[model samples]
Target: MIALLPLAVILPMIGAGVTMVASRRPRVQRALSVTALAAQLAVALIMLVVVDDRGPMVMHIGGWSAPFGITLVADRLAAFMLVVSTIVTLAVLIYSISQGRDDEEEDGTNSETPTSIFHPTFLILATGVSNAFLAGDLFNLFVSFEILLTASYVLLTLGGTTERLRAGAPYIVVSLLSSLIFLSGVAMVYAATGTVNLADLATKIDSVPPGIKATIAAILLTAFGVKAAVFPMSAWLPDSYPTAPAPVTAVFAGLLTKVGVYAIIRVQTLLFPGMFTTVLMVAAGATMLVGILGAIVQPGIKRMLSFTLVSHIGYMLFGVAIGSEAGVAAAIYYVAHHILVQTALFLGAGLIERVAGSTVLARLGGLAAAAPVLAVLFFIPAMNLAGVPPFSGFLGKVGLFEAALEGSTGAAQVLPLVIVCLGTLTSLLTLYAIVRVWGRAFWRPVPQAGEEHPPTGPLDPRGDHPMTTQYTESRRRAREAARRRMAAAEAARLPLGMVGATTAVVTVGLVLTVGAGPIYGLAERAAGNLMDQQTYVRAVMDTPADGAADLLIDPPGLSPAEPTAQDPGGTG
Candidate 1:
């Protein structure tokens, strides 16, 4: 079973090479990509089952042993993330293929178009995401980020339109800055402890001075916060994500930020336990309030959803801030829930664009009557995202709130309690924001000729509100252009494959809600394993301390506590 660990990371990379080689054959590339993702999902599920039955699984590359050779570890958290992420990537791939087919059919374009690059880059992206989850060392995790970021740059700028290039430029600059910080942090960790292995660092971090440890933690957290789009550092997300192709945007919004959140979870829990609770809690409250406020004022669907995405991340950070077993478990559950629901919503938004020819609320109307199926698809996920009752979103948030209340006491609990109230307010505001979109874009009657659609005014981020005539006129012209586009799109037929992929994603979101009980149970176990950090350290180092061998069987010829050549005190 240990051998299977590398396969999950390697198979997608192989698939990427094959797809690139077969770039001229669209059918072959599509088939190969789908097969690769399917196999990846299977491997992930098998790993999940194995890890659940047994414990964490570890693989040492090139027989060099831990702290020297590369290592891959799959605990319950890694396995679960792998399965969920693979499912999302596969769905998005199908949607993208359908989209490409539709574009070629409509435009009469040749096979050599930019769409040819999508499959290989997407596969490479999946491989990077898998590698990040399974990586056992800080340097390896940095490599994974670089892999995904390189692919993402291509995906973001695939069309090379002025808008996409503009968005991609800022995204690239921000990502590179974050990577630099991550690399610097890795170097510092190595210089301080003489080992980059996460398990080794876990044991050695305590010996470092408190000030240096705090500085390292701050640098690392800042880098990850930029990636995760936490408040004060999240202004880039809404502007950057809305310009990409719908499929690209969907996967980016769904999977990318969560990877950062996952890193924060691992770093906080494993590397620096109980270090910065107050700071995280304060950030959580600000993220929730600011994000929802931004969402409330956006006029575009994708931008609004993007802000909501940032807002809901606060919920996960809130869980991490609590720093308890239940808190971490709730966070794990919420992360899984958010990934599915956000992907579904974005895919549904794509379908809406296909039918309405625009995502601006002012230009879209009567969708409930013209495209009831698309409306249903959009409505379910929108409600789920807003934390509607009996949905996974609600359950996840409830779990987090409960955990926050239970995990702290007295004055230590005051901030979390305040954040909980603020979270509830954020939830209500989220519902209002989505419902506003639905009411204007779906429930309202289509505007007649010369009806003069009402203006909602510019989305003021600073709360200064005076509507300018020039701004209103610009909005009117945009709406008129959108109307013309919608008129043209009305003649085109919607693709069944695209709709089917969207429907499947939405159904998966529903499944999360229905299976919340069993899923949350799994999250609890994953969190339990995370809190018992010694178990992970032992598994990776092959050192079972004092009868710990009975809990998990290590591979043969793997010596326990082998000292590294670089640092005599470093534990393998």
Candidate 2:
């Protein structure tokens, strides 16, 4: 099983190559991609069970030991993240496959030209995600980010439509900037501690000056904050994501930002414990408020969901800010929950777009009467995201609030209290946004031309208000556009594969609710190990020289403070 740890990343890479070779055969490519992700998910689930019961496992690469060779460590947190992430990628892949086949069948040709790259690039992206989850060193983590971000560029601009290209340009620029920042931070980290291995740094970083340590931490956090789409840094996301293909948008919404959160959690817990609590708390509140505020005003489902996506990130950031086992535990569970729910909502949005011909609230209506299954799909995740009771979202939020209130203590109770209030406000606002979308996009009558009052202005010389003339003309244009979209979409049938994949994801989200006890227990245990520096450091650095023994079974002999021959001067 320890040896199989690397396979989580390897299988996907291998599949990417194989799928690329078989691209001429679309069916073969799809089969290979699905098979690869399924295998990766199996590996991830096995690791989750193994690490939870047996403690962390460390596999040194190429027979070389840690702090020198590449390392892959799977503790409860990494394993759990891997499991959730693979589930999402797999479901999205299936959805994408169905969408592609349906499009070709509808048009009787490959309307989406150059479709060959999609499968391979998608698998590579999966590989990158898996690598990131298991990466035991800073450099490898950076490499993983590059792998995924590069693949995303291709996925985002698929078909090279002008709209997609426009969206991808800023996305590319922002991504490149974030990558540069992350790379610089990695360099600074190495310059400070002479090691990029996370476990090794966990011990060595303390010896660095306080000023330098703080600078390094802040630099890394800023880069990760950008990737996670934390407020102020998040402006690029809503514009950038909504233009991609449905599966592309769904997967990006679900997995990419969470990876940034995962990095923040790993670094904060392992390298610099309790260092930026105040900053994180303040950021969490601002992100929640700003994100939801943007959400309520959006008239489109995709954009609204995108804003809510940014807003919910605040909840996870808040959990990390609380810095307690319970707080971190709740954050972990919420990350998993949000991944599933958000993906389902985006896929559901895709369905609504297919059925109604548009996601714009004014152009969409009466979906419940036409497609009740689609309505249910969208509704479940929407309510779950808004933290409605009895759902995993609600359970996760309650856990976070309980943790915050319980941990609130002398002289600093005010911050937690204030954040709690803001979080509660954010929740209500999120619910409001969801309800507005539900009412406008689902319950209202299907929009029809000539529903508005007749113009009595320039277009109709009897009009009293000139502004009304302009408003009426714009409405006329919008209605016409909606009609065209509907006319085109009317001939397309809803693909069962797409619906089934979304249902599977939504069902998994429900499972998080039904089995919240055991899952939260896993999260709690993962958080405990995360907060304990020794568990991770020992697993990575203290292994036996022969290295045949299971890391979980044999404790490392060397102390964290001592320098190995690998670092003769302790300043590599």
Candidate 3:
């Protein structure tokens, strides 16, 4: 059964290759891609259940021994991430099919370029993600990143339009540079240590001097920081992600940077275990500040959402930087919650752009006039993103705060205190940004005859507003009924095949919240297993090393997750 685990990853890689060859046909590609992802998701879910019941599962490729051949292992944490990544991919893929249909129908085009390219690259992206999470070796992790990055370059520029070109170029440049830096770090690590296997490195870290390990750690962190959109390295993300078409934007929002977070978690815990505190704390502080500040300044709905995504990412990193079981659990919980809420919000943002005629708040108005049900959808996830209570977001944040509180540091009082203040302020800023979107885009009236050509204002941290009554009685009544018929329209709007793809994926996110208790338990158990490292080592290697292991990752502060080292599935 464990040997079969690698086949799950293999299936999607094969599916992606086949889809790439058949890109000229949209329907065949959709059928195969959805089938591939559905199968992957099923496998991931099965693995999750199996791991829960039977403990972590590990497989060595080419029948090589642990820390020798490539190892694909599934622990509870990684399994949870596999499920999340696969689910997000499935959901947004369906959204893409619906997104481009209008032009396809209008132009008598059966195969739109972006829609056709979407399936192949999306599956490839999924494959890369699964590989990253399952990789037991550092070099294999690097390879996983390259696969994901290459797929992203295609997906990011799917349509090859001027706007996409403008957006994608920076993403490509930055991403490529980051990859190179990461590669350089990988080379240095191999030179310094005999093997690149994570478990091996963990056991071997005592042999490396602090200075040598620090240099390697700095190199890897910079590369992944760029990938994750941390503070200074985040410029490309807000610009690129927002300008892509909606479904692409949604997936990018939901999945891409999260991978970077996964990498950061992997490297900091597994590679530089105890040394992550000062630098990570500083990075987390800056990332949250700058990201939310950027969000505050962005004018359009997606752009704001994009910036906030980067901002809130810092919260999870803060937990990891703190490095305790509770912190890691918080990070994991947040990741699961954020994937759903962020993707949902981005998709809803796309709906706003389509129905409202613009993504900027200034141009939109009184969607309550036409699409109030969407307003509710938008509202739920937006509030969730803001870390409001009763939703998973709030719970995740509270957990992190508690972890931060219990841990002691020289700077502890200030860092945790600042985190609390910033969390509140950022939530307010996020709410403020969302409300600004609602004010002009949903609550107020659309511009009257020749009132203004819009998305026409400067991006502002705070926006100006003029209110009006845009919809009359009939329009208002129709808006109220939109809620009841939302699901029907969601189905009717898509052809049968397209509808099925979306329904299946979105259902996963909906279901995640339903089993929140068990999920949190899994996340916490995984965190505990990670902090101690004995369970993970035994799972990967079949036996604990008789002597010292090679990689001695510096665990961060004791307040948060100790930085789990298995693949890219970070708890947060």
Candidate 4:
């Protein structure tokens, strides 16, 4: 398990390179993708157990102690990320493979599904994601971004349709620009401190003037803000995500934006921990307000989900801004829950789009009757995503609220109070949006001869024609079909494996919520790790870089005035 830790990060990369070369051969490409992902899953699982049994493991690549050569470290937090990311990718990749004809998709034989191109890019994308999670230095992290972003550019424009081209172009450009900004931040920090390793930088950062530190942080945040979709910075998200195929959209929504959030969390805690509390507080507030508002205005199925993605970014930041162990723990739990829920929800919508033939509310109808089990799958995450009680979302948010309340001393609690209120408001608004979808698409009657061309029903005196008794007949049919079509769809439709795989993902989502106890504790531990830099440092530190004073941020549990060298951040 110890030796396998380093190999886990490197092996998928080898697979990515191989997939890229063999992409022209469909069979070889699919084999490569499956082999690589399965290998990763194995490594991640092994590492998970190893961490549980033996604690964290650290690796200095090329066997040259830290500071001189790049290091790839895996502590509980890093290992946890690896395990979660690999599992998500495995499931998503399996869904993709099942979705289309393997042979035809690999070679683009029919021109409708290109398996060859997707296999390589998707594998490469997963490799990049895993690398990013394991990266211990700034430059390597940037390299991971490039790998993933390049693969995404390929995936986004895979089909080459005009609507896709429109969406793909902006995504590519924005991502490229963010990369440039991130690279620039790396250069600035390097010039100032002479090392790109995170632990080295932590010890060195304080020697630099506060103003310069803030500038570097601002530049880095700009890049991550764009990536993470933090409020005003997220204009590109909703416009681009829904344009891809269901598999591609699901992975992008699940991983890419969250990576940005991860970066934001890492950067705030590592380089500029001193300023994190205030900066994150403001961003969290605005991110929540703006994201929910965007969802409120959007009318399409995927677009609303996209905006909800934007709003939820604030939840992670809330944990960060709160700057307490409990808050960070909640953020960690939220991350794990949100990743599963969001992916499952998007796939559910994809199923709806497949049957109802549109993601827009106006074009969709009577699907609850058409596919009833599909209704349950789609509805559970919708409720959970909105933070409904007894689900993961509510569980995560309740923790966040506790963190916020505890962070304040009565008077400062006003901001937290407002945050809780806004979280509730966000939930209410999200419920309104999803319910609006249900009313229009599921409950309302299927179109009659004349109503096919007309709006489903007459406008009321108030100009609002909401779901009413008109749905009684449709509701009855919806229930029956919901029970029947679930098995029927998977049992019948042989062409779209995406359909079956999506159904399976929904089952997994339910399981995650039901088993949230162990998962929640893991997240809390991760948050605790994140807030305390020394633990991560001691885990990753080899020969400390000379510029130590400028970079150090004490880990969460330690007192600011009394840092111990043998503590988590110290050199072994």
Candidate 5:
């Protein structure tokens, strides 16, 4: 299984090429895409079990060793993420295939011929994601990001519509800016330490001057922060994501930002431990508050979910900031939970759009009455996202809170406690926002066509309230027209593929809840591995004298730190 690590990235790349070759055959493309992802998922699961049982596995590209050539490593953290992400990509691909490109304009865009670029681009995106998780060096990670971002650029503006183009503009700008920052960080890391290999950096970074270390850390954080959509850097997300098609939006929401979070975890735990702790905590609280506040006010369901997506990222960041074994473990668990729930919610939002013809809260109503199954589909994930009890979301939060409390004993207790409070508040407000959507979009009676209403005030001095009546009546007429259009739409029957795929994702979330113990146990061991740097460094660097191992050239004059399992708070 360890030897098969490269297949995670290779399978998708090959799948992308095959998909392009079969682009003329949509069914063939779909079959190829699904088969490739299913294989990748299987490989990832096997890697997870192997790494968890036998420790981190390292694969040197072209028979070159670490710090000298490209390396792909699958540790517990990387393997776990690979499993969760593969599940999401596969589910989203299935859902998209079921929805079909013919329904592309179903999201309200002008009708056009469906493009074949989607399957190839999607597989390429999956390849990028897998590569990022398994990348053993900063430069390889950077390359992985570029691969995915390039694929995303094509996916986001797939149809070349005005809305998608408009959204893609800022998204492209922000992504390019982040990529530039990340590239600069990689350059500086190489210059400072003479290697971009992560395990080697863990050992050698300590020898660099404090100022250089802090500068590199700050630079990397800024770049990854933008990628992760953390708070002030997060403004790009809600505006950018909602314009893409449903499946595109679902996969992006599920995996892309989490990859950034994964990078942040590596940087904080492996390269520069204990740097920027306070900054992460403060950023997490602010991200939660501002994101949820923005969420509650959005008129459209996708935009609202996007904001909540931003808000929940803060939770993951909070866990990283806590920098404890428990904190990181909880964060890891939460990341998996959020990926499934958030993806499901977005898919459910897509279903709602299909059923009601629009996702605008004002334009949507009586969904529960019209499509009860869709109502249930949307409701479960929404509740889970809101951290409702007995769900994985709630359990993940409880773990975070517990970790915070345990870590709050020292002089720095105040900040962690305050963040916990903010996290709780965010959860409550998220529930409120979810409920508001449920009421307006699912419970309230659908507006009748040409429904009439009384004037807001008496007639103006001229005994005619033209301003109020004109504005009010026009808005009312538009709403009624929307209602009539939706009512006239073909019966709201959801495609089995979309619903089954979504339900599959939702079931995975429930599996998280039911299997929280074993899964979180895996997270704890992953967190343990992250805190103990030598387990990773040795796996990559140590060579067996046995001829069974490949010929290796050791990095000269570089002394790695001794093998001591240090806590995340340790200042090396």
Candidate 6:
């Protein structure tokens, strides 16, 4: 079962090449991408069940063992993230295929044209995301980042349109700069600790001088903060995200920043426990306020959603900043919830654009009556994203608030409480932003030419013209056919493939709401595993009791203990 870990990474990589070869046959490419993701999702489920039943699973490539070879570990957190991400990728693949089919029809192109590379690049992106979650060492994590970044470069600039190029340029520059910083941090860690393996670092990092430890933490945090879109480092996300195609934006938004958050969780819990709590809290509050404010001001749906996405990340960071087992658990649950909800919202935004011929709130109207299904699809996830009651979003935030109140004390308590207030305020503001879009874009009547205001005329439930008597019965069929063709061309009525895929993902988000109990229990266990770094170290290193005692390196001022039979790996 541990061997299945690498297959999660390898299968998609292989499929990427296969997809490229089948690119000329769009149907073949689509089949390969979907099959690969389905298989990956199945493997992820197996890993989740196995890891939950047993414990963290580790595999060393070629049996080289420990820090000396490539290592893949699937703990509950990694397994859960992999499963959710694979689901999102699969849904997005179907959505992209639908878009591609529309493009092919519009251009009158045959399947053999090789006009798009969406499938191949998409698979490569999936490979990168899976690899990152499973990475057991720092260098491999860097490699995962590079792999995803390379794939994203292609995906972001897919059509080579002027807007895409402009968006892709800033994204590439920021990503490259962050990569350089990450590599430098990795080098510094290796230099100080003599190992880039996370398990090894969990032990060795404590022995480093306090100043050096702080430097390394700062460097790594800065690198990840940029990636995670934390406050003051999140300028790149809103602009870069909204310019890409719907599926691209959805996947990037859903998975990419969460990976950074995952890394931060690993770093803070496993490598440097209880460090920089105040700084994290401060950043968390600012990210929430700043991001939501940006969201509130946006006129376009994608840009507004992108800003809200950044804002909600602050909620995850709030959990991290609390620095407790409960906090970590809540953050993990929130990450999963956000991934589903955000992806659904973006996909829903795509539907809106299809119906209105734009995402601009001012240009859109009457979707509630004209496209009731789309309105429902958009409304559920929109409310979910806004942290509406009885939804996973609300539950996740409540968990974080509970954890914060439970964990904080004295002056520390004040900031966490302040953040709690701000978080609540942000939620209300999010609801306002989402509702503003819904009210203006869906409920309001469509504005007529030369009309100073939208007509308050009653809407027909069947979406008939209010003045139906004006059309002669003889002309009705021809008028209806013309309207049908126009609707199809404009995507006023969405394709089943697109709507079905979006609905599938939205259902998954609802599952998070319905299954929050067992899901959060799994998160609690994962958080415990994260806090007990020794279990992970032992799982990876396979050290004897005596060797484990020697490996134990507690932070300065703390005494190390001998390893017992039950605790072969000493406390990290």
What's the TM-score of every candidate structure? 0.90, 0.92, 0.85, 0.85, 0.91, 0.88
> For residues 486-561, could you state the per-residue lDDT of candidate 5 as single tens digits?
5644366688899999999999999999999999999998999899888788878863322123212222222233
Q: Which candidate has the highest lDDT of all?
A: 2
Q: Score candidate 5 by TM-score against the native.
A: 0.91
Residue-wise C-alpha lDDT for candidate 4, range 1-572, written one tens digit per residue? 44665677667778777877886776687777778888988998787666644445666666656666777766666677777777777777777676666435456453434776777788789878888877888898999899999999988877889988899888988999999999999999999999888878888998998888889988988898898888778889899999888778888888898888777778778777757567677788788888888887776889989889889989888887887788878887787777778888888787776665567775566677667777887888888888888888889899998988884787778887888788778778888877887787777765443233343768678765465555555555555554453344434333356656666666666666788887777777776666778767766663233222212334435565554553454432
Clashes of 5: 0
**lDDT on C-alpha atoms for all candidate structures:** 0.86, 0.88, 0.74, 0.76, 0.88, 0.85
| lDDT of each residue in 66-176, candidate 3, tens digit only | 787887777777888898888888777766766556657767663334645677787888888899988888788888898988988887777677888888999999988
Q: For candidate 2, write residues 507-571 as lDDT tens digits.
A: 99999999999999999988988999898998888764345544442212334354544343534
TM-score of 6: 0.88
Q: What is the per-residue lDDT of model 6 for residues 1-572, given as tens digits with 9 covering 90 to 100?
A: 55587789988998999988876777788888889999999999988887787567777776666788777888888999999999999998888788768757768652321334877888999999999999989999999999999999988877778988898899999999999999999999999998999998988998999999999999998898999999899999999999888888989999999999998998889888888888998899999999999999998999999999999999999899899999999999999999999999999898887776678876666778888899899999999999999999999999999999984589768988999999999999999999999998888866444232233467588865475564334245444543553354345657788899899999999998999899999899889888888868877887332222222223223334645433457543
**Of candidates 5 and 3, the better by TM-score:** 5
Q: After superposition, how far is residue 195 of candidate 6 from its true place, in Å?
A: 0.5
What's the TM for model 3?
0.85
Query: Clash number for every model?
Result: 0, 3, 30, 36, 0, 0
TM-score of 2: 0.92
Tell me the spans in candidate 3 whose CA falls farther than 4 Å from its real position.
Answer: 110-116, 409-411, 453-514, 543-572
- Least accurate 10 contiguous residues by lDDT in model 1: 545-554
| Cα RMSD, each candidate | 7.1, 5.5, 8.4, 7.0, 5.9, 7.4
The alpha-carbon lDDT assigned to residue 312 of candidate 3 equals 88
Model 3: residue 449 alpha-carbon error in angstroms: 3.1
By lDDT rank, best first, the candidates go 2, 5, 1, 6, 4, 3
- C-alpha-based local distance difference test score of model 1: 0.86
Please give, for residues 1-572, the per-residue lDDT of candidate 1 as tens digits: 77668999999999999999998998999999999999999999999888887678887776656787677889889999999999999999888888888888878773322656989999999999999999999999999999999999999887788988898898999999999999999999998899989888999999999999998899888888888999988988999998888898999999999999999998999998888889998999999999999999998999999999999999999989899999999999999989988998898888878777789887777788778888899999899999999899999999999998984679888898999999999999999999999998888866543344544556578653356666566667766765675565555466877788888888988888989888898899889888988978988887232212322532223344644332246354
